[model samples]
Target: MTYVSVQTQIYSPQGWDLSDIYKSFDEPKFEQDLTGLQQKVAEFQHHYRGQVSQLTPEEMARCLQQLEVLSEQYSYLDTFANLVFCANTRSSEAKQFFNDTKLALTRIYNQLLFFNLELQDLDTTQFDELQASSALQQYNHYLNRIAQFRPHRLPEEAERTRNRDMLTGRFAFVQLYSVHRGEQDYEPVATPDDKQVETPAQLEALLFHSDGDVRYEAYCSLHQEMERHNGLYGFILNAICQDHRIESQMRGYPSTFHKQLLAADVPESVFRLIMDGVSDRIDLFQRYYQLKGQAIGQKIRTCDLNTPWTADDPLLKLDYKTGVQTLLNALKPFDVFYANRASDFFSKRWVDTKVRPGKASGVFSFPTFAKHSYLSLCYTEDYHSLFTLAHQVGRGLQFSRTRDRQTYFNTQPPLLLREVASIFNKLLLFDYLLKEAADDPLRKQAVLTRMLEDQFNLLFYQSTISRLELALHERAAQGSFDHSFVNEQWLEFYRQLCGDAVEVLPEHQYDWAGMSHIFTQPFSSYQYAAASIVSLACYQQYQAVGKDFIPSYFDFLAAGSSMNPVEALRQTVGVDLEDPATVNGAFYYVEGLIDQLQAML
Candidate 1:
């Protein structure tokens, strides 16, 4: 059998032709970027550093405009190089180039470090005076964000010292932790068919196999393999926890996660609601799993939980082109502008969809304004993969529409609102599949089963992750950073959620080891649970208003980070996040879906 190289097909469609972001790594534009950034940084230092408070609003506006332009160019270079490196980590040339570019960007960026610190010192009278200027008024949101840092702002020399210390001291510990995890090799088990596949993805595929013996062995062997490095992993966890504790105290945060929620503009109460709501709804998710167990003809265990409800049809091959087309059709109901952007995404090669070695495991669309608005799936052509495509594109579309209106500083919305568009895409696809599933009832039920399981994974598993993060931070505050303790905490929660419906074996307990998100973004998982609820409400509006809902939806997409999440969402969807009703409505919808699924059963 000839092995087809999926690597060649992973390139962006039009490749460099679509954007000047990088015509080629060898292009003179990169050098131009280096020179241009240096000039901009010098100009920024001259304009803002110690002189910002004295400048008129008009001057500040000009400074911010220049900064925006510089940021766009700088971001394009960084985003493109990062994308290239993401596609192939083995490409030393790309890796080295990215490192060089990043170092250069950081050097340039450090000059503007005083921008926020100085802005924070500006009095309300100065801010009100600045707001009166037409050019500066567009950036009120950005200005307000900087102003909020007043309490945390340190003196200029101290800030620089802290930055230098972080570079040399803080990151070094994280790197050691990463190197230890990277070197820990968990040996793979032999499959029932006697094929050897060693990677995490392949191992996951086996654990989800229809064959119970195969799944059990893969699950047990994998966890047993992980147990060998428990001590080292424990050290890594403690180090990470300690890192957060030190920073939180220095930043004057109440706890480690306090800063994250404050950054997201969400309250701790809202975070608690996500955990409580999902916990109460565990029965609904458990029932779905039990139904999946019946469909797969297996004794449901943590290991066997991933078995496909609908068996693969030998005659059917889900190709890349077909997958893209399915997403196109499912998303067709949106407005013409939205549809056009989606079409451009595929036809212009705006999406990077093929899976390959050294690539990131999960799908996400980056919201860069100048480059690819959304970098999407490493497509596997599986059913779940299709939904991922839809979901990520939804996020990209939101960015594409909104980027034109919002300046760079305002584009990074709170994480809570950031997930709204992505989850909406998922709900849209789920609704479509449930309606148009192949005419056989069993087949339809099978599709629903898959969708429901996917929901549970997002709602329950991810919420569990969020809860674990919450607890981890609490421990970090107490100066306790034990990995084994964290693992035990996870297992206890797993048992609580699964109840007696599924058995989580001791060997299966190291499941947290594989979570890439925990290391990348702290306390980020709960947003998914909130997003699910928000999307359900948004979908309800879509059902009620029909296509008439398109404009406000577009408006929401276009708003970007212009307003606070709650205010922005209210401006678009007219819902209040602080209200218990808004969250309860989401739980109620999940309960209702479970009722529908149960009746079908």
Candidate 2:
């Protein structure tokens, strides 16, 4: 609990007020709501369990309307459990409550799982009749989505069995990793003096610090800690990937990736297209790294990929107040709606930015079914944190707006578009910075360098992760992938990505072991690459169309999961996910960025 941030000359860091979720976890209403939820689930099961297929369209719509209400309550309880646990990961009470709530949700969800299965079970003529009904006017998208899963539906008992097994199975391992991440503290890098860090987030901050020795020491220490636990992390990753592979096989999917593509409502063809696109255009990045070596006065290593290329870059340490204001000003050019909604984030305590002890490691915005979102991130005084704040603000705005208008089932935007809105806002901020620093060559160069680094992270780095995941999953389907095999594949991805422009460290092979997402969600990292493509196109469209792009973009965000990603992107950004040219266009855009940076240099 050391290093509690205090008020500085500019502003103070603060935590989000959880009052909007509940006054306190122990509030009487918390218990009352849990009890009420139990009763409602019982009533719903009694009313709708086996009768879903027999109901008329009006009855079915009414049932769904009621189910949405129940879902909101479930969402609130789950969100509360998660947020409380994140703030104090060692809290036994929070742990127990979150686990108990998850069990309860699974049970209730099993009861309602029949709703979609039964609707999907209807014969085609009757299903068509249901879709044709006026009562289903607003529920068409939800019904159509349920229909999409019809071919993948398993026997009811198997689905039920899997639901019950999740509590003690793969999901338990996720918590195991969380426990490890939360309790494990790190020794910070020495700036001629060694210091222990209070949070892993602070330890990670060193990797992007202005000191090379500090970055190296911290990188070694952090990776060594995770390396020591490689067996446990490997087990977690293997078990999760195996479960996914087995489930996909049982669900009649061709491969493990087919399932994730299904969840994203995208096709395998589109994923491949984007992957090949990014892979083909990695030369600019190779050149960028060469430029990095020139700027930093040394040959770049894998660890040094994170170091800033230019030392003369302007170091703008934006505090909390200034950061929020900066986001609003940058967003104002795109649309006032985006700017104003982001402003609400500060006025309403919707963000948790205080870098304190026992908080989560990374940044993410939690979207609630209650039509509001909460952002949690470890804020530092750097461009990375500033842009991340802006990033989550984009997600917060999307979730709040989507939930306000769409039904609970349809409120979540597809993963592909979810990253789009966040990254689009990020590009806007970058544009603003470049414009602001036009008079200063060094500042603009720094901005370009930073932007290039981001492109590398999203396009090259994430795409490599995706490639490793695919290779690992394919290999895992054959048998268990051990520590050696995993490490070798990890190193291969690094080499494949950077080619020979940067040196590789053997210790860096353990890097994949530390990525929590690959354990929790394999095959999902590619979505960042996919979304980056859509974002580049969106930004380019914004430039060409000017203010006229706002309404289209707004409508795109508001669409949520109502349409496929390809359709949405085509309509809004005029980019087709299936087209090879669309992929080539994104690479060309990155090349243009390198052109700008090279000219400036």
Candidate 1's residue-wise lDDT over 184-229, tens digit each? Answer: 4446677656776554445555655666777777786667645776
lDDT of 2 by residue, 24-76 (tens): 88899987898899899889988888887789988888998999899889888
Q: What TM-score against the true fold does each predicted structure earn?
A: 0.89, 0.95
Clashes of each: 1, 0
Instruction: Output the lDDT of residue 312, model 1.
Output: 58
Write down the lDDT that model 1 would get.
0.70
> lDDT for model 2, on a 0 to 1 scale?
0.80
After superposition on all CA atoms, how large is the RMSD of candidate 1? 4.9
Which residue pairs clash within candidate 2? none
Q: How far does residue 260 in candidate 2 sit from its true spot (Å)? A: 1.4
Please state the error at residue 419 of candidate 1 in Å: 1.6
